[model samples]
Target: MALIGIISRELGNLTFLVSLDLGSNKFHGNLPQEMANLHRLKVLDLSFNSFSGEVPSWFGFLHQLQALNLGNNSFTGSIPSSFYNMPKLETLNLKFNSIEGQIPKVIGSLINLRVLNLIGNKLVGFIPTSLSNASRLETLEISYN
Candidate 1:
């Protein structure tokens, strides 16, 4: 249910705030680390794909990013801790991946956070107190009791 004929370039002329939805596809292989070049990316959806490997750390470089979806992929590894630097990030949907490790205390850095869904993953450790500081937070779904 997977193949590699994916649209591999979006940065050639993309400038304005952009949104991409490539969910429910049969894409296989790593998410191209080139997305960070879309410095103006405001929303991105890559859910329900066959993407493997670690999510690139450069995602934190997208200062204009407002929402991001990397759910239901085969991504394996700890979430890049640098994600806390995206000061404008509002909605983050990373619900179903192979992501392990504690939700970093840095998540509190996302002051504009509305939804933080890390539910149904292999994460472990105590919930970080930093998350509570997000007064704007609307939802936090992680399977840890």
Candidate 2:
């Protein structure tokens, strides 16, 4: 059976952690702010969970994050503008959520980004022209807004 419950703030104590995959669980509630302390994280997947609340802006603090997947959750609100700070990010998956707002143009600043999946959200407006600046992007799924 999948795990169910709120993540402990103590999880943030793993300062040397590199990859954390807690996807496909029943975890609900907002992520612990202390998770922002995972500065060395490279891959973080919290998809297919019951987590709600805004995607935390502190995610930007994980500068070493290369792939992040928060798809198929109950999260609401716009993609955090702070995401642009993840300069090394390669894959970002935020599909199948209740998130609203236009995809930020600053997304282009993630020059190393390769996959961006936003297939099922409430995003409106034209795809930002600055996306062309993401020359390394190979897979972009934005269907069913």
Top TM-score hit = 2
Q: After superposition, how far is residue 47 of candidate 1 from its true place, in Å?
A: 0.5
My TM-score estimates for the predictions, one after another, are: 0.89, 0.98
**Regions more than 4 Å wrong, model 2:** none
Q: Pick the candidate with the highest lDDT.
A: 2
Q: Give per-residue lDDT, candidate 1, residue 99.
A: 88
What lDDT tens digits, residue by residue, belong to model 2 across residues 1-145?
4999999999999999999999998999999999999999999999999999998999999999999999999889999989999999999999999989999999999999999999999999999998999999999999999
Question: What is the model-wide C-alpha lDDT for candidate 1?
Answer: 0.81
CA lDDT scores, all candidates in order: 0.81, 0.96
Candidate 1: tens digits of C-alpha lDDT, residues 5-31? 554656424656478777878876776
- The true-versus-predicted C-alpha distance at residue 90 of model 2, in Å, is 0.4
Clashing pairs in model 1? Answer: none
